[model samples]
Target: MIKSEIKKLPGSQIEISVSVSWDEWEKYIELAAKDYSKEIKIQGFRAGKAPRDMVEKKVGTGALMDAAAQRVVQGTYPKVVTEQKIDAIGKPQAEIVKLAEGNDLEYKVVTSVIPEAKLKPWKKEIAKVNKEYEKKTAEVTKEEVEKEIEEIAKSRVQHVDVEREAQDGDNVILDFEVKKDGVPIENGTSKNHPMILGRGVFIPGFEEQVVGMKAGEIKDFELTFPKDYHAKNLAGIACLFTVTLNKVQERKTPDVSDEFARSLGKFKDLEDMRKNVTEGMEEEKKHELKEKRRGALIDALVENLEVEIPHVLVHEELHKMIGEFEMQLQGMNITFEQYLIQIKKTVDEIEKEWEPQAIKRVKAALALEELAKEQEIEIPAEEVEAEMNKALAQYKQIKDIEKNIDLARLYNYVKGMMQNEKVLEMMENVK
Candidate 1:
């Protein structure tokens, strides 16, 4: 027989004390001894074929008792949780309280459980937001269309080498290196980099210094980084730059006309091109507006949600956010360690700063889950499978797709996504 006691702890955690009878302990001891026989050497006996007495004598009473306690705890914790109807999250932390040869086993297990989410009235809030969004139109102004057209024309601009000093609106190719206090800065050297003058793409004074330089001209100047520069180490610091102008090219932007449209190989005329651009801008604006509305909906839901979020969930979310941040840094060709050095902050400090956001994200997810439950929204298995298959297809070109992907985890993620979508759609379409 097994005896147990359960206590609810703060922060959505539960503690369970379980005691197993001596008979049960003895059974596990025998099993443990049998397991040890395969690994423990005994004279005149084949591996795993030694008798229990010899196995126990060889492995010692203490080792056998420890192994038995482990087995007993592992075999009993799940049964206790299931019998008690505990909705545990993450892993249970186990601690042995009592273990001895020929005696009962006792252990304590602490685990986090799902918290109760008491949600406020959110349907009306979502309906109001949806109504507000419905009243607003995603309209693209003529100026916006013209601006996009100008950008397209600029993309097709021709650059012709000219033997003249670099000027505003002229493309300049240059080699440059920046140094602070006579020491070269990392990632501050470039060769044959091309930039158009008057773009303000470089430092405040750097572009002006290049404006008068002709091809083959080497000029040295000093500039101060902006006080609010993204790299904290270089912010508000003076740096010396040595720039060698290699080439100057005058830029000629094409006129937006029927000929330009024909050259694009898709539009029939300038009017057709304008129409497509306008439509594209409109679609983009609509998407932006839709995203804003979705954000507002989630914000409203989170505002009305009341739940004690588990620290474990927030910790998990923080690590997920960190992973995403690391990926973004990688995209910029910066290592995470280098980013930390540039920002002058430790990972712990960064995570502390992101804690509130992590908590908010957790609350928002809980709110969505509550809404789904209230609405009885469920994602079909077939839909989850289809989405999983679609996701898998994207990575099918990679070798060993099955080994690389956790299919069970991917399925759960897809199902959660589908469920959230269904719930959000219901809220959006609430009459």
Candidate 2:
């Protein structure tokens, strides 16, 4: 195996150019043939049943040659980098350096990797936060539960439909058409869509338009979409909507009875349902409070951090956030393109919005890494194993993904994240 020094590039790229001798090339061919033999086919044999020589001939010299090259690069590149004590990151760009039988197998793999960073000194500033928070008692009081019950009960509360006009919080069934410049905006008209007043799910000020509309009332209103609206096309544009009330109904969420509790499934009575909901809320509150503390601690650490966060990592994190945002939009039956059209933004525009958050995450990661060093926070192998197992279980729906994933990469990422959690907790308690 021919070895070479890795070349460092901006944004975590480590490039290594290398060549293999004829012996090495032959070895790679054998390796590739073993991995790919089942797929090879040739004349005078069943599919994938040809002899090695026949398959190689049928597949063409070039195909086997390329495969041989890939085998050598894929197997040797990372091993060489590791042996040479060079850190590589992400997926490297592999290029054929040379290709000729009996000459040499040659290639270069450019990998993006996280660089070594200095750990920041743990300071006294973070200790006090933990102390103060520790002093505050966490409670899931009965009063709070009762309050939640009352709020939910209000939704199902019996109400008389007044002859007057419907107001905010009153239910109205209506048909509406939205238009721009006297022409209907695409997908802007609705008939008998069940809309709840005061839900706030509509665009800002949309729910307000329905308030005070009496039965048989026809209302036309023009409003401007907020510039920051999730949809691009309609963002910051004023449009007109024509709404006609088809019916008015008051909500009575079936009084807090046994029947109502059973309707929701799994409750002995109203009190049982309230208790369960309260517990759930209590857990949610605890999580939220913990998150706030963690966020504050991370903020502090990043504020004091010193290091160059790889742009690659920032982009990766940003991409994850974008995927989540897109998923949420998808759940609402909106595509990313549709969202862009509605908000009048391209994917790049969406990316720009998340850039700041990405930077913050990267900074926090660097700070946490430093903090982890200072605190000697070591993630146990068992923890990494457990994390991997969990991830693998989730990969069942993804074909070939379990095998294709680079486990070392996943382990490092998870290990770093776990250490960061410890670092944040330490920072939160730092005085």
Count of backbone clashes, every candidate in sequence:
0, 24
Model 1 clashing residue pairs (backbone): none
Error of 1 at 246 (Å): 2.1
The TM-score that candidate 2 achieves is 0.62
Residue 138 shift from truth in candidate 1, angstroms: 1.5
Question: How high a TM-score does candidate 1 get?
Answer: 0.81
Worst lDDT 10-window in candidate 1: 390-399
Residue 376, model 1, lDDT: 85
Instruction: Write one digit per residue (lDDT tens) for candidate 2, span 1-431.
Output: 57566677766567787877787667777666554667754456665455557657667778888888888887777678777877555556789978998887778777777766664554654665566567665468888887776677676566545566767666777899999989998889899766778879788888788888887899998889888776668889999989998767676655667777776667888878987988888888888888877776667566667666666787888888888988999899998888776667787887888899988977777677666667678989999889877878876665577568887898888887777767676566556
Please give the RMSD to the true structure for each candidate, in Å.
4.3, 7.4
Where is model 2 more than 4 Å wrong at Cα?
26-71, 82-87, 98-101, 104-106, 125-159, 164-169, 175-191, 195-244, 249-289, 330-335, 382-418, 429-431
